[model samples]
Target chain A: MIGDSVPQGDNEAAAREVASGPVIHIRNLRKEYTSVAGVIPVLHGLNIEVMPSEFVAIMGASGSGKSTLMNILGCLDIATSGSYLLNGHDVAVLDRDTLAHLRNDLIGFVFQGFNLLPRASLLDNVALPLVYSKVSREEREARANEMLGKVGLAKYRDSQPNQISGGQQQRVAIARALVNRPQLLLADEPTGNLDSHTGNEIMNLFKELNERDGITIVLITHEVEVAAYAHRLVRLADGHIVYDGSSHEGAMSKNPTEYSAAVHSTS
Target chain B: MIGAMLNEAWVSMWANRLRTILTMLGMVIGVSAVIIMQAVGQGAQQEVQESIESMGSNLLMVLPGSSTSGGGVRMGAGALSTLTTNDAEAIEELPTVAGAAPSVSDVAQVIYGARNWSTQITGTTPSYFSVRNWDFAAGAPFTDTDLRSVTRVAILGKTVVDNLFGDENPVGKIIRIKNSPYVVLGVLSAKGQSLMGRDQDDAILIPITTVQRKLASNQVAGSVRFIMVQVKSAEAMPKAEQDIVDLLRQRHRIREGAENDFTVRNLTAMANTAAETTAVMSLMLGIIASISLLVGGIGIMNIMLVSVTERTREIGIRMAIGARSRDILLQFLLEAIIISIFGCLIGVILGIGGALAASGMTGIRVVITISSILLAFTVAAAVGVFFGWYPARQAARLRPIDALRFQ
Candidate 1:
C-alpha cells in the first residue's frame, strides 16, 4: 500500500523505502523530572512508529503522557531511557549542533499556543526557520510566501500576530511549520487553544497535506473528536499506550460530530 | 541568517515602543554628553595655546622680585636696580638676541573732551612692539626720532579706541594723560580677551623716554619696571636668557650665593606648563565622559535582559522552528550594537554643534577631528557587544520546553 502511494520509478522506490521505513521510530522511550521532593516520571517507556504520508493523532486525558511523548519526538526534550530514531539518525547520541541540524532538517512543529513571534509579520514568522538553514533571502521569502498562500494567509502576510484573530494566527503557525518542508510534522495540542471551527479548519489543512503532498503528521490532543481527523489514533493512559490502530474501528466509531458540536457550543 | 536575525531584533525592539525609546534616550544623552565635554575641553585648551603662541614663541620676560623672609616680614635691604637700558643694550648685542625693550606701566586717568577713562599707560622703547609681536590696525608705531626727542605720542589698543574715541578716529587725536596732552599715533589691533576674562586690548603704549622726561620725571631713566627680550630662534632662547641673567648679576655686583634681584621667565617653559595643566584637565574630562558611555552600556544590558525574559515563549517557538542558541544570541547582540551605534552617530552631530557654539561664545577655536568621531563610535560598538553578551547568552541558554512552560 505504501509503495502504491509512491511515484513510479527506481529513484521514487528508493525514496519511498527511505521515507516509509518510519520517519519517527521510538522504542521504550521514557522521560522523568527531578522535583524538590523526588524524581517524577512522565512517560513510562512509550513505543510508537509513524510511516511516510501518515496522519496520526495521540489522544489522552490531562497528564496522560501524550504531550511528553510529543516533546521527545519533536527533539525539544530528550528521553530518559531507550531511544528515538528520526530519519534513521540516533537522536540520543547526537551532539547539540547535530540535534539542531536534525530539528531543522527533519522536524516541523506546531504548538497549542500558536507561538508566532508577536512582533513579526506572518511572512517573517514563517521565514524564521530558513534563517538557521542558511538559505538565500530571496528563496526564503518566496518559500515563505508560498507557504502562507497554501495556508490561505497570503493577504495577511504583513500583519503582526497580535493584529490577526486567533484562527489566523494558528494558520500562520501552520504555514511556518510547513515552510521548512521537514520529514515529520509534530503538533502538540495544536487545537487546544482554538475554537472548534478553527480547529476543524486546521485539521482539514493537515488532512489535505497528508493526502495530496504525502507529508507525515503526528498530532497530540486530549479531545477524541479532534483525533478523528487523523487516519490513525493512539490512546494513552497512565503514561503508557493503551491502544494503537486505525481510527475508524475505535475512537472515530463514536459520533465525532456531536463531540465537535459540544466543544463548539461551549466555546 | 544574520540578516533575518537582525530583522527579528529590529522588529522586537519596535514592538515595545516605549521601552526601546527610553533605552535609546539614555544612550543618546550619554553619548552626547561625552562628545560635547571632550570637544569643549579640547577647544579651550587649543584657544589658550594659540593665545600664548600669539604673544611670540621665543620671547622672555624679566620681572623684579626678592625672596620673602619667614613670617612675611619686610627686609630693610637696599633695592637692587640692576635692570637698565644699558642691560637691554648689552642683551641686544648677543647674536641669539633678536631685539630687547624696556617697559614701565602705571594706572593713569586720561581725559579727552567730556569722557574720562582709567587705563594703564605702558611706557616702552621703540622696539617694544616688534619684540612683543603687536600689530597696528591703522597708522604707524613710535619712531626712534620720537623716542630720542621725547615726543608726547601714544598708541591706543582696541578697547581704548572704543572707550575714549567711540566713533571718531583716535589716530592723530589728542588725549590728556595725567593732565599732559599726547597725540595718538596709531591703534593696535584687537587681541580679544584672555582666559582670566581680562581685556587684552585696553592699554595705551607711549615712548619710555617721553614718560621719563615729560609725564613722570620722578621715574628714573634706565630704571624701567621690566625688560622683554626676543630671540631669533626658539632653540636659542635658553642661552639668551642665561647670558642676560649672568650679565645682569655681574653688573649688580651680586655674590655667588645671593639670589638675583630679577627673575627671567622663558616663554617656552611658561607655555609648556600651561599646556600640561590643560592636558590634565582634558584627561579628567575624558574619563568622566567615558563613564556615561559605560552607564549607557549598562542600560542596554538591563533592557535586553528584560526583553529576553518577556519573550520567553517566543524564544521557545524559535527554537522549535529550528533557531539555534547562537542565532538567538547573535540577534539580541546585533540589536544592542545597532542602538548604541545610532546613538553615537547622533552624538557626533550634537558634539559638533556644542563645539561651534562654545567657539562663538568664548572666541575659542575648536577642531572636531575625524579620529575622535571614529574612536567614539568604535567604543560605543564595543560597549554594546560587551554589555549585550550576558543577556543574549541567558536567552540562548533557555530550554525550549521550560521556556514554553513559562507563563
Candidate 2:
C-alpha cells in the first residue's frame, strides 16, 4: 500500500520532466498600433519562453510594452509579426474562434483591477468564463464553489465584489483564473493596487500556488519587490529585454552596488 | 439563452427603476389613448346606427327639398302640397308597403299652469307610431274615431311628460297648446338622444285632423307636408321606394326623367352615411395615435443609444470574454424590445380602462376588438426592433480594445 501511494519516485520524476516542458513559447513577437500621430510601435520584436510549473515575472515601466506582450500571450490580442506557440499550438495562425477556444481552454487572466462584474456575486463572477464556454449551470456552480473554497472564500461566495476588501477581491480573481485548471496563468500587475502588506501576502499566496499545485504563473509588474518573489525575472526597457535570468542573479547583475548596498544598509 | 437574456433585461431594467418607468410612460399613454379614442368613436357610431335602425329599417322619409338647392332658399317645383292623404293611401296600397302616414310638424309653446315648455307638435296618422317605432308607456294611442271626430287628444313624449306632469300621470289631463286645450291620452316611452344631439322624445303627437283644424289651418291645402312609409322588410326597401316614386310621379302627371317634388330617404341610406362619417373620424384618430407611437419608438432609440455609450466598458468586457458580435447585438436589442413590449402591455391595459371609463361616462357602447389590441402591441414591438437595431449594431461592431479603453 505504501509503494502504491509513493508511485515509484524515479518514473514519476522522469514523467514530470517530460510533461513540464515549455507551455508558452514566444519568438520575435511584435505589435504595433496606428494612431493619428502615425504608427506607434509598442512591442519591438520580443522573444521569451515560459515553462510549466515556472513562476516568471516581467518587469517594466509604464508604456514599456509589457502589457502588449501579456495581451498577446493571453490571446486577448494578436501579434502583428512573428509566431506565438502557446501550449504547443501556433496561436498566430489560429482563427478568431480557435483563438478564443485556446484562451478559454488553456489560459486564465487576472487583471490588476480584479475585473469582477460589479453587479454579479463572487461565485457568479468566477462562473462567467464557464458560461461563455456553454458549461452546464450545475457543473459551473460546483466548480466555482470548489475554486472559492480553495481560495478560503467559500462563505463569501454570495457576496458582491464591492463588499470584499482589495486582498479578498484579488483572491477571488485568482480563484476565477484557476477555475478552468488552465496550463498558464497570466496576472497583469496583480497586486499593484494593494498596500505593501497585502501585496506581500498575495505574493506569498502565488509562491504557495506555484510550489504546491505546480501551476505555471506569469505576472507583469513594475515593482522590484513584487518581481523578486518569482523564480525567474525578465526586465524590459524601451520594448526590449534588458535582462532575463534567476531573480537573485538578475538583481545582482543589474544593480550589484544597490543590491549589496541595500543588504549592508539594512543591516 | 433567450430566458437568460430576458432575465438579464428584467434585472437591468429594475436596477434603474426610474429610467425604466419614464421610458415606458410614452408607450403606455400612446397605447391607452389609441384604445380609448377608438372605443369612444366606435361607441358614438354604434349609438347613431342603433338610433337610425330603431326608427325602422324599411321606413322612408319624404323631406320636401333636395340637398343640392342653392343658398338654402325655398323653391317650390310645384306647390309642395302635392303630398296628400290620397298619396299616402296610394303608397299604402303598394304591394311592398307595410304602412304609410302623412305628417306635419310645428314648434309651439305649451302652458300647463305657470310652467310653459317649448316643444314640437307633430300631427300624424295612427300608422305614425308603428312606422317611427314609438311605444306608449301609459294610456293608449288614438283610435280611428279620434281621427274622424278631430278629437283634441294628444300623446306626450317622455320629456314633455316629465316637464308637464312631474311625478303625476299626464294621461287624461288637458294642456294648452298655443291657446287650444288638448287632453293627453298617452305618454311615449323614453328614447335616448341621437348622435347628432337631437332629442327623440321631446315632442307631442296629435291626430292630423286635429292639427289641420286647430293649429295650422291657414297653411293647409289639400295635402300634408310629408309622408312616412314603412316597407315590410329592409330587403324590400328599394322596391318600395321606387314604387312610391312611380305612384307619385303618375299621380302628379310628371314627364319621364322629370325630378319629383320630394326626396325619399330610407333608414339604411342614413345609417350608411353615418357609418362613412364615423369611419373617416376613426381613421383620422388612428393616424394621430400612430404618430404618437412612432414618437415613443424614437424616444426608445435615443435612450438606447445613451445606454450603449454608458455601458461601453461592460460591452468590451463581454466581448473580451468570448462573446460574439451577434451575441452583443442580440443582448442590447432584446433589452430595447423588452422595454418596448412592457410599455405596450401597460398601454394596452390603460387604453382598455380609459375606453371603458369613457363609455360609462358618456352612455355609449364601446367594442374593443382583439385585432386592435394585437395590432397596437405588434406595432409597439416592431418599433422597438426597428429603433433599437442601430444602437445595438453600433455597440456590437465596437472593437473590444477600443471599448475597454473608452473612459
Ten-residue segment with the worst summed lDDT in candidate 1 chain B? B73-82
> On a 0 to 100 scale, what is the lDDT of residue B64 in model 2?
57
> How would you encode candidate 2's per-residue C-alpha lDDT over B258-285 as one tens digit per residue?
7777768776677778878987888788
The RMSD of every model to the true structure, in order and in angstroms, is: 6.6, 7.9
Instruction: State the lDDT at A232 in candidate 2.
Output: 93
- Each candidate's lDDT (Cα)? 0.80, 0.80
Interface RMSD of 2: 2.1
Question: Candidate 2 clashing pairs?
Answer: B32-B351
Interface RMSD of each: 1.1, 2.1
In model 1, the clashing pairs are none
TM-score of 2: 0.81
Candidate 1, B63-143: lDDT as tens digits: 664645788864332244446776777777888899989887788998889998999898888788888788889989998
